[model samples]
Structure formats: C-alpha cells, structure tokens
Target: MKLHTPKTLPYIPVAPGALPILGHFAKMKNNQVAFLEETQKKLGPLFWLNAGFGQWTVVVTGEAAHTVMKNKETRSDVMGGEGDRITGHITTDTVSIKDGAPHRRIRGAIQSPFTPKGLTVSEIGALLEETAEKRTSGWKENTKLEILHETSVYALDIIFRMLGVADLDLPLWRKTYNDFVGPWTMIPFNFPGSPRWRSLKARDWMDKEFQKMIDQARATGDTKTMLGAIVHGTDEEGQGLEPKELFANLRILGLAGHETTAATVAWMFIHMGATPELWEEIREEAVAADSPPTSPKDMERFPKIEALFREVLRLYPVINVLTPRRVEEPIEIYGVKIPKDTSVSASLLSLSRDANLYPNPETLSLERWTKQAHRPKPSEAVQFGGGPHFCLGYHLAVFEGVVYTTIAARRLASLGLQPVLQGEIPKPTYMPLTRPPAEAKILLKPNYKA
Candidate 1:
C-alpha cells in the first residue's frame, strides 16, 4: 500500500502568507474560491497552508486529487466527526465520518435505506413535486424572493416530511437548524451571543427532539420512517446502533441531508435564470415528458434537465471539499511523503474546473455532460467526492434535485414566470458547505409564453 515518492522532496510545497499560528485562516475566510484559485496558479496542483491549528496540504486538481481520494491511508475520521460538535456530543461513531472497519459496519447497517432500490422513486418524486407546488404557490409576479432562503426552506420542509416528522415544530426547527450550522466555519468560542454558543444551544434542543422521536419509533415499532429503519436495522454482525450512535447518525442525516441540497438547488435557479434559452429548453423537456418523473424509470424522459443538474453540481459544489483528514499513517502522493497527522484535503472545487479535464473550464456548458466527446472522466468530477467515503446521499440528492427542479420549472413556465437576477449576483458563502448569500434574489418575472 505504499506509494512511491521522490527521494529528495519529502513534503509538498507550502503556500505563502503563513501568519504566526493562525496561518491562512483570515485569507480563506475572506474568499475561499479566489484564494485557492490564486494559490493553485502560483504553486501548481498541490500546496499546503496552515488553517491556524496545523498545516493542511490541499490537492488542487489533476492527478494529485485522484491520488489523494483513492488513497485509503488518508483516513477521514481523524479530523472531525460527521456531526462535529453537535453530533459529537452524542456519539463519534456515525457512519458518515468513520474510517476503516467501523465505517464499513455502520455504513453497511445504514446504507440500504439510501440505495437506489431502497428508495421508492415515484413516491419520493410525488412528495417533492407536491412540496414544490406548495412552496411556489405563494409567489406573485414582480416580487423579489431570496433564492437561497426560499430553496433552503423548501428543502428543509421536504426533508422533514421525508423523515416522517412533518408535524414537528418546523419554524422552531428551522431556526435551530440555522443556529446549529451558523458556527461551522467560525473560530470556536462559547461565550454568550457567539455563534458557537448559539450552535450549542441549538444542538441541545435538536438532540432532545431526535431522541424523543427515536424512543417513540422504538415503542410504536414504526418502521416506516428513516429513523424507524435505523432503529430496527442491524449490521452484517447483527449488531444494532447504540442509542448514542443512533442519535448521532440521525443528527448527521438532518444536517447533511438538507443543507447541501438546499444550497445546490438555490444555485440551480441562479444558473437557470442566467441562461434563459437553456432554461426554456429544460422546461419544454419537462412539459413534453410522457409524464412527470414520478419514478426513476420516468427520469429518462428529461435527459437535458439531468445534464443541467450535473452541470450545476460541477460549477457550484455544495460540499466544496470532502471532509479533510489528519493522516494518522504516512502516505506519499505526487512524489511527496505526507507526514503522520498532517492535514490533507482534496479540493473538489478545484478538480471540477480543471481545464485539462474540462475544456473552457470557467464556462457553464451543459454539453460537457451531454456530449460524449466533452464529458469528463469519472475521476475528474468528484463533486460528491471519491473513494469509499463518497457521499452516502449522492443518489438521493440527485433524485430530489431532478424531481424538484423539473416540476418547479414546468410550473414556472405555466405561470408565465421566469427567474430573473436581482441586483448584483452575490458570491457563495464559503463555509462547511458553500451557499449563496442570504440577499441573493431571483425575481419572478412575466415571460411571454409562445
């Protein structure tokens, strides 16, 4: 399992502006996309920076990224747990963040529910379509709606319903969800009024809520909802999740499930608004479909819409970087030996836009995915990441995105409405997940229908 490395060069190149102790935290916080791109241009594919705690080596693009993602020695669990502070308080054994055998066992136990076969595509699609209609029903002509907030709320509501908790205090949960994620990228501090403080308070509330649901599901033997499945599921060893493990895993699902999809869907609207011709074609495809994509089989009807969804993920990856890891065992990649405990991350943002892999990388061209000649290699588009730890919810996210966007697009067209950008387009916030700014608006404008 050893990778060959150059005898002379032991470590990767370090990017400039290493401040005492704090490192490049300030620069990254200011504008992550710009900073990473700039550094890559200067330092080539792989470079290191100290994000305050320790030096982190980032694989920007090309073979280096593939090398890092494929290497099993670069274990994911060493950095932070799937739920971080929130879920960590409950248990660190959630499948999403675990490495090695434990990860396999937990993943095996939890994986079935998310598999393509396990999901009832038509049922999920129908539910999402209904949700989308309700969300868009209130929109009026010429009104400005913040795309991120609107999409976030829409996604949150749909996910809650899918979790079989639609009756929960959604408004309160929404507030809590925001607070829980608010401090993800901020420096950890727990004083009153701080993001960390508020997040902890939010986590406390959520922990209790999920625990109650778990207890109820166990008591009632309700195997219908996701929680019910997990509560009842067992691994290859016939071992079930402990109460803490179950609670933590559920929290991971709650946070990771909703936020990333919400961000991507918000960006999808922005891309659609920016490209009207493509939007029209997609809408027409949705309208001309044999029937709305109630099932995965029916999804084949909108190939163009599916292509557009892939393009959106490439351009704006919600989880820009997979969870970075502290290399517990030394690993060599790109002729450099990464020492033990050195933080290493594969930059999905950089890899998706590599000109070598994607021609005219900056352009939002759906043809790259649609056209056989232009499509990237499997390794190039690591938007959901690579290796054994690739996003568990990848399929579900795509299904939800395609189902929600296709139906929503048709509805918008029927109402003689189209998305129009309001003011200057705001840059995405670079947090644990990339999100469009809160003020990012898409106005519903009257479009003269043919």
Candidate 2:
C-alpha cells in the first residue's frame, strides 16, 4: 500500500547526534529509557531516530501510542520480514514474527484451552500454593534467598502446567529455555559455540520435545490439553496445523509465557518488600475477606492486590517496547505525519510513567488504582497493549499476578518479613529487556498481628 505524501510535509526531524555510521546506537545501548526520555524532551512527542543502516524508527507518545497500536491500516510488519530476521534466528515459529491470516489462525488454535472461562484464577492459585510450599520448604532462618531465581522457577512451572507440559524435567527445561530466549534480546550477532549458539541448540531440543508431545497426543486421542487442542484442531479448510506451524505456536507460547510473567512477578515481590505498608494492607484485605486460602474465586475480591500488580507493571513493564509496526498509509499522529513503510514503536515503559498521565509516576502506590476519582480509563494503560494484537494472555497474566501476589503478601505478613532497603534492583545487562537481579533476598520474622 502506497502512502500519500502531502505537499506540506509532516515528517518530524529526530534530535541530532552521532557520526554518520554510528547513529543513536550508543545512546540506546547505554540506557534505553533515559536516552528515549532525553530525546523526547528535546524533540517533542514524536521524533525519528537512526537505528543502523538507513532505517529510521519513530518514537511516539502516549496519545499517539494509542493510535499507533489501534491503526489496522498500519500492519504489524514486525511479525514478518525484519521481525523474522531477528526472532527466526532463535525459533523458526516465533509467533511475534507471524503476520496476517497465519497469525490469526494460529492464535485461534492455541486459544482453545484458555476458552474455559474462570479457570485462570483456580489454576494460578494451585500453582502459587505449590511454588510457596516448595520455596519455603528449604528456607532456613537468617539465610538469604534469591527470590528472582525462585520466582523464575515458579513462573516456569505455572506456565508448563498451563501449557499441559507439567511432567517435563523443570530444572533442565528452565536452563534450556533461558539459554534460548536470553540472546534474542541482545544485539543480533551470533558467535560460534557462544550462548546464542547454545540457545539455538536448546530451541532445537524444545522443537523436538513439542513435536513428540503432539505425536503422542494424536496417537492417544488426547484432546483435553492445550497442546492436544492445537494438534487436533482443524482450520477452516478442515486441515490440522502442519508440524512447523504447531511448533512455532508452542515456541512463542512457551518462551513468552514464562519469561515476561516471571520478571513481573519478581519485580512485584521486590516492590512489596520495599513498601511494607502496602504489603500489610494487602495481607489484611486477604485475611479479612475470610476467603478460602486456595480458592481462585474468592481472591478476585481484592482489587487492591490487583491494583498493586498494575502499579508494578506501570513501573517496570515486562516487555518495555510495544510490537513494532510499519505504516501502510500516511498517518498523522499528534500532528506529525508518518510516511508509508515507516517503522515505529510505542515506548510502553515511558508512557506508563509519564507524569502527565500518572501523577507521582515513580512512587509505588498500590491505592493509585483504587482512587477511581483519579483513575484513567482502562484503555489508558497499554500494559497488555491495544487493538487487535493485544496480548491474548492478558487475563491469564492478571490472574497469575493476583494469585501469586495475594499468597506472597499473606505469607510475608504472617511471617513479619522486614525488607532490606537497597539500591534499585539490577537492571538488564541488555537494553529494552527484563532480567531479574543477580540475588533477590528478603527477610522474614514472626508477625505480631495488630
């Protein structure tokens, strides 16, 4: 689709820096959020930036961000072409790289298990209980534990059960999955026998494992699980998904599901530890609700807990950048015209913390969401994104967040955990990525119920 170029020209110039060849790569690499914020401050809401070669990326604001995410004409090109160039290196079927009909078809097939309404709460509660028991089972008094590692493992287990792959060796699977996804966020260089290479090896292993499960499900006539649903599901043409497509869907589901949720949950715990007042409030709510400890249905009553999760997401979104899209037609956003085929991305991390939208954006206030008088509409927060490509797993993510946070809050309150105030948690070594701290520790003592 060719975009109409206006005679008056709407293209906004990016703030100038760097030599001809280097461009803004250095600034982006050093600290992506700060660099972008600095650029936005100087260049205004929508500005362009050189990101290698002749490619220019348009960084947009929150208002324009809503439009960009909802613009159907501006196709999600990242799922194909350039998206594939990067994601395909790790797994050939990475769902983020698939576009158009294929993307829709695959998403439909995989969404079957999630169709069982109200299952998320129950499932997540079960998983959280299992994780809590396992984590505290080995805890010794005064011993420091890395919550990030523990939570990462817990998140993976939850995802595995949700995907109907619970029987696999978790430690080995965790190691392999981490190795596979770890390098994808880094610069697109692959070294011989490096971590990236090992990740590729892991991807191959995962592909085979998924394929084996698919074959087993088909042979055994098991259509009860998500994996089975995908394997057995037929398209409009009444044909089952090809092995490659099935593997691609599973690859994306497995990788995306575990990593993002794990990071967010770990961050949530860290924030709770830092702010004990919020933690106590959550514990009191959960206890006063008098709801069955393990019941998912009862947990939904705690909107404060849910709000706390949203606050954390606002501060540290798991996927800091929105999925990139290419303009198919000339579109004006915040008075700036973007030409056809221009690449653009919404800075979700920046937007969520925009002082204009969120007052006192840096503070961790769980009640911010409860103050309906000050709350923005649901669409204001793009944590799960907007429009057609919005996260299919959003409800599931929220359910898990509520379950894990509620359980953790209750347990911590009961134990009278006194969090150590430290500097900011470890930032990702790679830009625009979510990596947990090297060691995330919290202290616990007996609670004096007030």
Best by TM-score: 1
lDDT (Cα, 0-100) at 123 in candidate 2: 47
Clash totals for all candidate models:
1, 1
Report the lDDT tens digits of candidate 2 across residue range 95-141.
Answer: 45556676666666666555425354234456556665665555443
42, model 2: CA deviation in Å? Answer: 1.5
Cα error, candidate 2, residue 241 (Å): 3.0
Which candidate number maximizes lDDT? 1
Write model 1 residue lDDT over 1-450, tens digit each, in one string.
122222223456777776775677677666666777888889887777655644344544565665556646666654455434333432366776677777777777777667666566225676777877777777777878788888888778766666666545777788887787664524555688877778768777888888887788889997656667777877888877877777667766767778788888887888777767877878788778755677655666677777777787787777665666656678676665677666567888887777887888778776776676543343544888888777777767777778877877777877788887776656767654677777788888887554
Worst 10 residues of 1 by lDDT: 1-10
lDDT of each: 0.70, 0.64
Tell me the alpha-carbon RMSD of every candidate. 4.0, 4.2
Candidate 1, which segments miss by more than 4 Å at Cα? 1-11, 17-22, 52-55, 58-60, 81-91, 184-186, 373-381
